[model samples]
Structures are given as C-alpha cells and as structure tokens.
Target: MEPPVPSKPQFSLPVDSDHKATQFRLFSLSPPHMLAFHLAWLSLFSNFFSTFSIPPLLSLIRSDLHLSSSDIGRAGIASFAGSIFSRLAMGPACDLFGPRVASATLSLLTSPVVLSVSLIQSPLSFILVRFLIGFSLANFVANQFWMSSMFSSNVVGLANGFAAGWANVGSGVTQLVMPLIYSLLTNSFQIPTSTAWRAAFVVPAVFQAVTAILVLIYGQDLPDGNYSKKSKRSSSTGSGKNFFTVLFTGLKNYRGWILGLTYGYCFGVELTMDNIVAGYFYDRFGVNLESAGALAASFGLANVASRPGGGVVSDKMGRRFGMRGRLWGLWVVQTVAGLLCVLLGRVETLWGSVVVMCCFSVFVQAASGLTFGVVPFVSKRSLGVISGMTGSGGTVGAVVTQLLLFSGSNQFSTQTSISLMGLMMIVCTLTLGLIYFPKWGGMFCGPSVEPISEEEEEDYFLLE
Candidate 1:
C-alpha cells in the first residue's frame, strides 16, 4: 500500500494581503509576528550585551592582564573577526534550520565564552576569549531575517528598524550596566578591582544563556509555525532555497554586495564606536570610568529612536517613490552622518565633542536602519543570505576601520583617524546609485514596463 500523501502546510494566523503582518503592536505577544519580533530583538540584545560587556571594563582588564596598546587593538579586531565568518554561516544555517534554532544555538554556544572572561591571564587568552564570544553576534542575521519573514513590505522597514534599534539598545545598556556592576562589586562589596572585573562578566553570561533557552522553547520560525512542525516538502518550499542555493543566490546578486559594502560604514562604524567610545571618553577627556560609560551610553542610546526613525522615513519614501525613494533617503542620511563624524573629530571642547558625537550617532545608526530598509527588497528568495552578507559587512567594516585607523601602530591621532574614517564613509555612500530593482527602478531612473516576477511582486507590492 502507498503511504498517505503529506498535507500541505497551512497558514492560519492573521496577516496582510502578502501573508505578512500589517501592524506592529509593541506590547502584543501574538505568535509568529509580534512574538517573533520580541524574541528576535531580545536574543540579539543579549548577544550584544555579551559581546560588548568587556569594553566598559577594558581599562581594568588591561591593567590586570598586563596588556599593551597593540594587544588591546588586537583583541578588538579579534572580536569582530570572530563575528565575520559566523555571520556568513548563520544566514545559511537560518535557511536550513530556521532562525529559532540558529539564534538559540549561537547564544548557548557563546555564553560559556562570555563566562570565560574571568580566566584570561595573558593577552593571547583575552583575545581568544573575545574571539569566541564574538560568535554570538551571528544572531544578528537571524534577527533581521526573522523580521523580514514575519512583516509585510509596507511596514518591513519599521519592523526591521524597531527590532534592530531596540536590540541595539543592548550595546548602550551594557555600557552603563557593566560599569555599574563593576562599581557595585568594587565599592559596595569591597572586592578587589581585578576580581570585580572578572566577576562582572557573570551577569552577561547568565543573561545570554537564559535568553537562548527562552528563544528555543517559545520562538516561532514562520507565520505558519515552527519549521520543525512542517513536513519535509513544505519546509523547503515555505522557507525558500536550501543552504548553498540561498548562499549562492545572495552571492550572485550585485545588489547584496553593494548593500554589504554600504552597511560596513554605517553599522560597521557603530560597532567600532561601541568598542572604543568608553575608552575614548576616559582617556581623551579625562573622565572617570563611570562618567565615560555614561557618556558612551548616549551614543548607543540614540538607537531607541534614531534607527527606527530611519525605517519610518524609508517606509514613507517607499510609499511615495518605491525603491528609488529608499535609495535616495539612504544616500542623503549616510552622507550627513559622514559629515557629522568629520565634525565630531574636529570638536575641541568636551561638551562640544559630546554634542557632535550625539548627532553623529543619530545619523550613523539611522543610516544602518536605512541600509536594511532596502535589504528585504534585494532578493526575497535569499533573504537570509542577503541579511547575513549585510550583517557580516558591518563587522568587516568595523575590523578594517579598527585596524587602519584605531590600531596602536597607526601614526594618526585617534581624532584624526576618525576624520579619515568619516571621509571614507562619504565616499562609500555614493555606491547607493549602483542599486536598482527591475520593477521598482533605480535611484535616478523610473520603473521599466517589464512585468514583475512572483518574488518581486511579493516583496515590492508596496510600490504599487
């Protein structure tokens, strides 16, 4: 007797005309849409927290481990280097295993590395631990992919922006939280500085592990349901191509490469700043540890509104001018952000530097959000791969900037190198002109009369 034919996957959850969520209710926990949004961002937040938790205590760690300036820079580069390949791999993993599994597995695997910060007795060990801990950042690809899967084009920018922006708050939160934890241990509890810094890492480790478990148990992979519940046939068709197919599809698309390069400056710059901002304030302005952490927090805290604003503006532009509007908006915002970064490097006074950094933070983060606002439209069939490529670009950009500009051997002063980095960002933003969608048109051109393919139709219906 022949076996029973597998029933087709059914999507019973409420969604828009495109089988995506129309509204983004902030407080709702409804499965597969809002619920997925919260899980994605929270998981990313934990990862970000774990990734940057050491920066706030870098000074103490440096003293404790007897690290040199070059060693510090190498550690920073190592952290970003760890993320680059993992992010590239995570895209394909999400395509094959689903974001729920991909995200949770990454967090769980990396949490132990985060906890290992206390074990570093040498520069090599410190760098190695940071490298391993950086793997948690691959969850960022999963976060963006999940949002793209769950939300519709009309609000995809907003959903992506909010999820990323909120998750980014972890960087800022770690800035403040790590310092406070260290202070409490050293001051209130009378612990030694060396012991306090090591102990501070335990909090982020626990946070990362708990969030990973939560995601694995409760998170949904698609609007329909978790990927595991679907039959073999439905899983492949529903989630798009398999790993290598999706990877190659995203690789072959010129648009994904251009966006990757563009994101490197925006989000990449943000990562660099997260690594150095506290130390910059501490050394340059003679601020105390807590004060420097507070100031550094300001730059990261801007993500709460600045990134979402970029997405909101992108959505508004897409409504008015399709992909062209989104591209134009990205160019303009990133250009302005570059200008602000140049200005930040020039500011001489402490308060002046703070003000300029705040403005620079806004434009840089918004540029990141805007960059992603255009990502979901690049190739729907390979969204995870495209997202991974873009996410990895951010880390690559950070590594390059850190190596050339901020690394210990560079002759350029920290401020001067920052100005040069800004100059590079301005030049990079020009590449936005190279991105063009067949149906929605290019930045300077109008849409062609050619018919929209099924993938284009689903991802760009808002242009109609």
Candidate 2:
C-alpha cells in the first residue's frame, strides 16, 4: 500500500576503453545517441543559417531592395513574428510527429522559402520571404526534444546545451560566410552588388535541403525504434491525451510560461542582437558592412563555448546541488546578462560596445542553455508541447524587445532603451530560481536532487 517510487530516465552512451565510439564517432554522441545528436545539430544549424541569412547583408539588401530603415526593421519584425507562430505550432507537431519527422519536414518545407529570397525585388516581397523563412527557426524545438530523448536527464542539460550551442553557431557562421560570399561574388566573380546578394541565398537553401534529406533517410526518433513504429497509439494521440487537452495542459503550466520568459531574455536578446548589431555598428559607429558583420559574428561565434559551458556547469552543479543547481545556473547567468546589457547601453566606443556585446552573448546564450536544462522536465508527457511554450518565449521576447526598444524611426535611441528592457525582464524572472519545478519537486537552496527512473519512459511523446 506504499506509493510507488517515481521512475528515472536513462540516456547513457556505449563506450570503449580508448574513448572513440566502439563503432564510429561523430558530433560527440555514441551508439544509440549518435544519429540524434548529429541530425539535431545539423538540422538546427540549417534552420539558423537560413533564418538569419539576410541580417549580415542587410546593408546590401536595404540598398538593393530599396528598403528604408523602417522597412528593414519591419522585415526583422516579420521574421520574428513568423518564428513565434511556427514555434507554437512546431512544439505540438514535434510532440505528435516525433522530432525526426517534424524536423525533416521543417527543413524541406522551409528550404524553398529560404531559396526564394533570391527572387525578391521589392520591400514588401523581401519582408514576405523573410517572414516565411522564419519557419526554419522553429527547428530548435525539435532539436531540443530530439536531444532530450536521446540522453538521460542526468546529462540532458549537457546534451541539450551542446546541441543548441553548436547549432546556434550558425548565426555566427552566417555572419562570417555571408560577407565572404558577397566579396567573392562581387569582387571575384564580377557579379553586381545587387545581383550577388540574391545568389547568396542559394548556399543556405542547399544546406537546408541536403540536411532534410539526411534526417528523413537515416534519423531515428528513439534508439529502440522510430516514433511511428515504437509508439503504440496513433501519432494524433500524442502523450496519450487528446491534442487540445495536451496543449491546454502545457498552456496551464505556469512554470513553463516563466521559463519562456527566461528564454526570452537570453535567446530573445541573442536574436535581436543578431539582427540589429550589424546595423547598430553601421549607424552608431560608421563601420562598413563587412566590418560590422565581422564584429557581429563575434557575438554569434561565442555560442561555440558559452552555451555548452553553461550546460556543463548545470550538469556538474546538479550533481552537487540537485535541481537547485540547474536553477542556480540560469539565475546567475541571466542576472549577469541583465547587468551586462545595462553596461552595454552606457558604453560609447565601438570596441567597448563589441566587448560588452560579446560578454553579453556569453551569459545570454548560457542562460538559454540553462533554460532548456529545465525544459525536458516540464512534462514527462508532452516535452514537445512544453518546449513549444517555453521556446515560443524567445521569439516573443525578440519581437517585444524589438518593438519596445529598437523598432522606431530613431534607431540609435531605441537600441539603448532595449537594454533597459532586458534588465527589467531579467529582474522579473529571477524569482523562478526560488521555484522547484520537477514533478518530484526540488530544494530551493542546497544540493538536494531528484532520482532517475530506468523503468518505462511513461507515455511522453518524442519530438524526434
């Protein structure tokens, strides 16, 4: 007549004495964990590459498309808006269809939209294409869900962080590569500045399309079987609940909503920075296009170390402090980020701003890593939907921050004000560090933790 012990999740990898996978090694995960990590990061990268494909080249795009400053801001808004909607839908889609199917579909579906940026000749058309291209950004939901299933909650933080961190480098990679492509096309190939920007879209589209095919052909939803094959119920009945009910369950989770806010501060800021930094440097400091992009790429590139570092910190801390450790990581990084944004606003020099911006990227992207450290725990049932709820916060944050601080005719002043917003929101979300969100509950301060279940995975839906 005793209450049953809650089960723990297992996601360990096979290893040999030498540390190379007994079979093959790629993207850092071992057998049963391999394809998931590989496909997740690669597909996530494709989406990011396509999503931010326009930003680094905004100067060229603005001139070529005859877009005014306001038009450029609106284009960023449109793109963010599209991502918000898609994140909302993709969360549920991933829950129902599995990450593999949903992700592959996302890449293939958005590839043409990404490629079609080549055809835009007017401001309205450019904005429309950018909006459609934002759908690619929703792949993060699938990427997280996929990693969650592939690894145990013990290491889920590291897995999620590493996957996202590396994937997010796409933004930085875009900044570096786009400028080079532009230079090559214009200088080497003798293509017109106007025409060369259009051709640049082809590279990302090709990458997106190829990754989609790879994921569909070879990716597995869970190690045991594919989502459709492993799951007993119809995909329509994800988490064994009615679709609307599952969604409502996610909607009602107040913690998930709060986590979404946290994501907004870290990732929302990252997205906004990705779009505006190039312009911020150009307008405020009078840097040339290539120079500005190179500067912005520093922010993007920091994800290579900062994000995964945050995840590793959480995992190590969780070992000592339990769930409180994870919350501690988020709180500390975000609080630092809030402070950094304020510093960034006050600094006047370009190099000073760049230094502050790079520092800010580290904490914000780390906070993003920490936020997802809590995501797969939101529901043992609907990780996809819950991830959607939280993930949607990033895009929402970007849009709101963009509108409130950066979206006006006076760009310079607006950019300064937006940092204040980041500071304010970080303050609001800080109390969540006091919360213990797991179903088994957690400690508020010290090193208390939760036990893992090796039994059946409970009917949690895989987003592939």
Candidate 3:
C-alpha cells in the first residue's frame, strides 16, 4: 500500500536577505521544500540500506559462503572502492541532469544489485557483486547536493545534517531490523535458511524502486524546476562544457580538499564502522547475531541526534562567530572523535567498548555535519564538484584505512586499527586548526560576502 499524503505546505520568506528574518522551528518545512527533503532522505535511506545490507548479515554470509574474516575485510574494500569513482561521476551528473534524475536513476539501478546478493557462490563473485552494489552508495552525493540546491547557505548546514542524519538513520535501522526479518522468513514461513537471507534483500529493493517513482513524480531539481529552466533565469547559465568547466574550477580550490579529508575522518569512519562494527562484536564478544547487530547499530544510532545537533551547532556558531564558528565546530568534533577512538581502542569490556564507540559515533557524525556546513559556502559556483569530491573522501578514507590495517591479516583485530585511525584523526584536526586564508584576513576572519536579496535564487553563494 502507498503512504499517506502530508498536510498542505506553508510558504515563508526566502533564506537570504539584508533585512532581519523571521524565525521558524528547525525542519518546519512546507510543500516543495518538505517534499524535496523527505524524498532526498528516502533515496539515501534506501541506498545505504542496500549498501550496508550485507554487514548485518555478515556472519551468516561468511558461514554460508565459506569466507574468512580477511575475505570480509576485502569485501568491505570492494564495497567502498565501487563508491569512490561512482561518487565522482554522480556529483557532476547531479549538476547536469538535476538531483532528482541522478538520485532516482542510481537508486533504480542499485535495486537489482540489492537483489543479486543472494546469487553469490564464491569469494571472487562475492567481492564482484559487493563492488557492483557499492554503486548505490553514491546516492548520498545526490541527496546532499539536492538539499544544498534547495536551501540557502544560512540553514543549509541544518538541512544537510537533518537530511543526512535521518537518511543515515537507515543504516542503524537496517542493522536493527533486517535480522529479525530474516529470522521470521526462515523460521515462521519455513523458508530455507539460505533462501531467507537472499529474500530479505527484496524489502530494500522494492522500497527503492517505489521511491524512485515517487521522486520522479514529485521532486524538483531546483526550487522551481530543472537546470535548463533555472539556467534561463540564472545570471550564470551555460552549456554542458560550461558545467564541467565550472565543476573543475571548483575542484581547483584547496579548501574543498581540507574539508574533504577532514570529512574522510568523520564519514570515512562512519562507513568503515558500518562495514565492520557487527563483525567486531561477533569476533570480540562471541555474541549471537541479534546482539551483535544491535551493538554495532549503536554507532549509527547516534546519527539520529548527533548529525542534526552538529548542523544546529554549526549554524548557531556561524550566527555568533561567523565562518570560524563552523571551522571551530569542525575542529572540535574531530578532536573529540579522535580522543574517543583512542579510548575505544583501550576498552576491554563489552559494554565499555560499546559505550566508547557510541560516544565516538556522535563526534564523528557531528564532524560530518560540520564539514558540509562549510561545503555550500566553499564554492557555490562549483558546489556539485565540491560536494562530490568531499563525498568521495569518505570512501577514500574507508578504503585506505581498511587496506592499511586489514589487508593481509587473517583476523580482524580492531584495536590496533582503531588506534591507528585515531592518530590519523588527531593529525587532521591539527591541520584544520592551522588552516587560514590571508585574503579573508586571519585564522578566524569572516568571508567578505555581498548581500543577497530574497527572490533571487542564484546569488546565495558569495565569492567573498
């Protein structure tokens, strides 16, 4: 059955103006904004749900496929490897075709892969399919890119965080719920054990397919319409070559690299955790499938509050402290996450380890929120490429961190790996603290921004 429709939307004054603005509650969204926001998270939820689907079932898949722990680690790499390049491509696609088309297209393409997990019979086939399935992970770029397009810089951080946090809530949701679905299908319905795990993928596939159709029907590329239509009204309208040119131009900026790499520590850790957390519990505590999945879910569950809280913090920081507030929040969260990871590595008890990990999750996810808080403000001209590259950093971090630690090890000993990554986070945090732009004047200087009036959609990004 289809979902119920929401109440009618109420419009408000636009996001940017030189005048004092009226305030509303966070996420008190109306028609078009509300529609775009929900649809973005729906697509992201389905995408990551598919991306991490195998992790919750990792123990079962390992036993069924006769795979080893090292094999699983390699499979994690395969999953992240598929995302990095695809994300780079998907970002520009969002810019050229519009986020609606990019998001729906990727989701529809991935639904089949979600279903195909059942067919793998060997280690090679497992990695191949896992890599192919990773393509769906790029849908997040579309999600945030779409949110960045719809909202103004003033609250884009919060909008980005809420959309991302809720969307990401699916990871925890999948880990929490998928096993129960598998058990029900296997035991109550008398489906074969092997068959039930495969059939479990059907839920996410069907959900993704239906979501694609909904987005196409209702979601908008811009606040008004598609790129072509909006370009006619934009001061900066152009052809396909112009879009790439603008995208590459944005890529040339170093601020994106710093944000992207710092993001690598935050979201990179999130992706790595989603892939390995269940396995960590299974191996460390000798827990059952349900307990391990729930324990691992603690890492992602923090997103429900952590990511939104990060956005609100960044927004409020910007309000009081200007651009430095966003950077300061980013620096502090990363520092906290690093310190927590260091502590997490030292914890020997089960609940103690879980608690440390959950605290680590909050700061890591919060840092991700703060990273994007700086993203829209980086280069509005090249927001698509900037977002894409920044998004790519997460996969890069996952691939590099995993390959460095688990590449040849037969077993997944997470403590040393955790400590190593924590050290890396501290280094990145220090670099963030030292970063400065002389043109902007000082370590904490605000951007020299031009005032933008409401109704004009294109000028929200200032070169200052």
The C-alpha lDDT values of all candidates are: 0.89, 0.79, 0.80
Q: Could you tell me which residue pairs clash in candidate 1?
A: none
Overall local distance difference test of candidate 2 = 0.79
Residue 54 of model 1, lDDT score:
89
Candidate 2 residue 96 C-alpha distance from true site, Å = 1.6
Cα lDDT tens digits for candidate 2, 140-168: 99999888877776677888888899899
Q: Enumerate clash totals for all models, in the order shown.
A: 0, 11, 0
**Ranked candidates, highest lDDT first:** 1, 3, 2
Off-target runs (Cα >4 Å) in candidate 3 are 1-29, 231-241, 408-412, 437-464
Kindly state the number of residue pairs that clash in model 2: 11
Taking all chains together, the TM-score of candidate 1 against the true structure is: 0.94
lDDT of 1 at 261: 91
Q: Please give the lDDT score at residue 420 for candidate 1.
A: 89
Judged by whole-model lDDT over C-alpha atoms, candidate 3 comes out at 0.80
Better of 1 and 2 by lDDT: 1
> Which residue pairs clash within candidate 3?
none
